[model samples]
Target: MKEKITYQDAGVDVKTGYEAVKKMKKYVEATKTPGVLSELGSFGGLFQLDLKGYKQPILVSGTDGVGTKLKIAFMMEKHNTVGIDLVAMCANDVLCQGARPLFFLDYIGTGKLDSNQAAQIVEGVAKGCKEANCALIGGETAEMPGFYEKGEYDLAGFCVGIVDKDQIITGKDIQPGDVLMGLPSSGLHSNGFSLVRKLFFEKEKIKVEQYLKELGDTLGNILLTPTRIYVKVILDLLERFSIKGLAHITGGGFIENIPRILPEGCRAYIDTDSFPIPSIFTLIEQLGRLEKKDLYHTFNMGIGMIIVVDPKEVDPITKFLENKGEEVYEIGKVGRGEKGVEL
Candidate 1:
């Protein structure tokens, strides 16, 4: 028989993946909060939910992945911020229901794990958890030599949150005349990179490292920028007021995610002129030839987290987030319509 080269022989590394887990344990522990019951290597994450503070306690869970945006991270070889993206993708979703994240777990699978690369990934996850005030309880790192091409990896995150049953914000209270407020986004938060890649690399004929004033970095760097985690800011406001709805702008942007939280007869009309969208979106739209509609449907367009509140509460909510250094804007208003978002 001719000599055979196995999958491992094709440069898929195994031990390196486990080593990455070992390397990131410290940073993971740094993000631990009150609910964590087990350490990183456990088969299952353990969390204890305390109901002492409320008459009825409810558990909330959300799961999400980094999508093809990982391709951008891979192309750029920048692995630090996506962990935050993974955390935000899930934690922010739970926040939409007005829950406080209690703990988070993640799954990372790769063709081969370079200890250094895996460490960077978990380090990012841990950093995100700490920023959102959730416990980094546990996670898994899988090394399947044949499953992925060498140097390719994927991330999926799971999170659990807690809220008093009566306090959950499910948009049930939304009505006409409720104000729509916007919190600006840092950049593209883990979605639409497939289109972004096509625009910058395939269509625009640009290199990843080419600098642009709008992005303030190489194309790859801008694409790899981390998703912003809005858990802390909104959770803070949850304590002081009753919010009608919360929408975390993600893959569907305002056009889709916003509608999910709107009541059956209520719709959101966003004012495109309200907030100053970052230069990156303008650059992409002008250079990539993307339509204004598709741009709002695909990307956050600089507004990441949207807070919908009753008209009476708008001033307090605005002043509260503003005091916290948030750039808040009166972006739109809720009105009676078929369930949808309008610009």
Candidate 2:
């Protein structure tokens, strides 16, 4: 008889894939929300819309990947926290439109299947879903042997949210004299890692385990810190305040992201000294010999999210956010003449 080559011989292992699914089930179950109508293994993620208070309900969707930050996770041999980064990158963007995140789905592509590692990654995802008040409906785990490196994997996420049309923040109302408030970021929050990697690993030749007194943590730990989800606080603010505009500081940093919501003839004037910049950013700036403008144009610095509101509403909003344990800073003000950001 001719030799028979099984599917497992070709690199994909069905049995191992099944084991991974079994390991991930419990973590997936913990993220269930009322809107989730399907299980983890379904053909599609099902979320039943709850249109109780919304008259003209609008659906907002966002998708993002962790980018080169995954390289750091690979170096640290840590598989958990990147899943949270995956969810936050998407959920935070959807929140910019003043939407409540309803459900999330993730994708994991790897060369070989490791059940424990897959479970750990999903556990992080579930934890993030709980924090964001969203459900983990469904996802994919692809095993392609030759396509990826042995111990490395890629992760991406999709988030769906809902908001009423009238409640949507379009920044159309942003005018001169409007106050800009900022919420502090946890750390690097998963952007500019390509430059970071070059500065630390390639140029400075710093090891991941190296400790820095300025940051008070190991280099790897600071770089791997998960992105913060602003859904809950922003949603609460929407109910009690007239928020003119919202911006989630992501890949573009302050220079690019803040202008995204600015209306015609309105510019943002940010007082950079208003908030304390995180040490990790400063380290990158010094090591890379980058200019101040380059740093703000590439990283979030310290501010992760920005809220635009009328000057009259700043005091009350700041008080409410402070009461919620958020570090609030009166970062800037909207100005006339141009449609961009001024540091």
Candidate 3:
């Protein structure tokens, strides 16, 4: 008789998947908020909206993945922090709309399931959810044989947030003479990695373990720093300040993102010297011989989040943010011109 085949033989292991779910359960539970109605294994996540103070509640949703930055995580063999990047990418986008993140779900696709590694990744997701004041209600782990390479996986996240209709920051109020304040970035914050990898690995042929004086750490460590989640601070600011517009500096950087919140007749004038650019960006520019416009067009260049506010309120807002230990900079101002950013 011919030997019987099993799902394991086909490269999908049900038992291993069960083990991974088992290992990740605690991390998932730790992120539970009052609104989360379903457990981690539920078919769909359930969040009870507390509409106590909201007259017209609006739901804001965002989804994103950690692009080629995953390559750096793969090189470092560290799986913990990438999940945080996955959550931050989605949460920060939702935050730009002035929403309070309620819950988050993550998806992991890989050739094989490693329970320990999967658990590590989920731990980071839970940590990020806690920081963002959201719940990690549900997620999926797909094991597809021959789909992804060995020891490699892809991650994506979905975030849902709530905002009152009147409280939604639509950037419609952004006008000429608005002061633009910036929140400093914690390194690259998970964008422009394709260019970064080419410069460091392909062109310069530098190893991840190599230490540089400028960065003050190993390339892998610096590159693998997780994206920052500004949800908590921004939410607090919303309550006490008259924030006109918010821009989460992501893939497009200053040139593309800043214009997103600009009004029709308003343009953004950024003083390049207003905030100090991180050394890693300077290194990339020097190594790649890139132009100023191209660098600002691609990476955050140092500022992660920009706040557009009434010029009169700048002093109070700056004081409030600084007391919270944020490295705030009065980076620029909105001016009367075409709808774009000028550096």
Candidate 4:
């Protein structure tokens, strides 16, 4: 008799994937935000967006993924924190336009469904949505057996936000002489990890749990610290400060992100000495013999979000973020002629 072959034999069991969602439905409902109408297991997830208030409301949406940082999570056997990274990646971009995050969705693809491990990630997503003042409306988890190696997974997120047309933040309002306030990051915050992993694992041969003084924890512990959510904090600061623009420092770090907010004929003159470089960044530099320019261009190096504001609002804006237990710095001043960020 001929042997029978099936998708299950290749390891792509649709039933297992459906079962994973069944397990997550209860946990997901607990994080339900108001407008979420339908339950999981349906042909398509339903989300009702209600904008009962505001004149000239504009919808802002952003999609992003956690990048190869997932590899570290797999190696460390830590899956949860990356969920926050997923939300933060998308939410921060939407917030940059001064949009208030309204809802979030995530896509998690894995080789196989590990209910317990996957739930940990979903829980962190719920937590992140709350932190960003958004609803965990819905998400998708696919068990694509042949696509990924066993124990490997990938994460991506989508965020929807709203902002009044008049209140939208664009670099056009950001003129030369505007002050740039930098918000300190939680550490790395989901960028440049491919370089980090290469440096530590391949070059230095350091284990995830190995403790280093600068990072103040095992390598895995520090790197796993969830990305910081700047939405809630910046939303509140908008009232007191004429926030001309915002820059979320991620992959390209200062070199790329800061330039995004500069108006034509204007540049950012950053005072490198303005803020003390965090110990963790310093540690990476020393260990890797990383060049100064590479450090700033590759990692947050300190700043996570750069707030471009009128010079007049600097004092109060600094006080506001500082009061929230955030370390805010006057990293630079907007200047003309350079057309980009100058350190």
Top candidate, metric lDDT? 3
Alpha-carbon shift of residue 190 in model 3 (angstroms):
1.0
Q: What global local distance difference test value does model 3 have?
A: 0.92
Candidate 2 overall lDDT versus native? 0.91
Predicted candidate 4 versus true structure: per-residue lDDT over 43-120, tens digit per residue = 555667676777888989999999988888898888878888889999999999989998888988888878777888
Clash pairs, candidate 1, are none
The lDDT of each candidate is 0.87, 0.91, 0.92, 0.84
lDDT of 1: 0.87
Q: TM-scores of the models, in the given order?
A: 0.94, 0.98, 0.98, 0.95
Q: Report how far off residue 221 is in candidate 4 (Å).
A: 0.4
**Model 3 CA deviation exceeding 4 Å by range:** none
lDDT by residue for model 3 (1-343), tens = 9999999999999999999999999999999899989977879999898899899999999999999998888888899999899899999999998999999999999999888889999999999999899999999999999998888899999999999999899899998988999998888998999999999999999999999998999999999999998998999999999888999999988999998888799999999998999999999999999999999999999999999999898999888888988779999989999999999
lDDT of 2 by residue, 1-343 (tens): 9999999999889988889989999999999988888987889999899899999999999999999999998899998898898999999999999989999999999999888889989988988888899999999999989888988899988999999999888899999999999998988998999999989999999999999887899999999999998888988999999999999898979999999999989999999999999999988888799998899899999899999999999999989988888789999999996799998
Off by over 4 Å in 1: 1-14
lDDT rank order: 3, 2, 1, 4
Q: Which sections of candidate 2 miss by over 4 Å? A: none
lDDT of 4 at 290: 85
Worst 10 residues of 2 by lDDT: 33-42
Q: Which of candidates 2 and 4 reaches a greater lDDT? A: 2
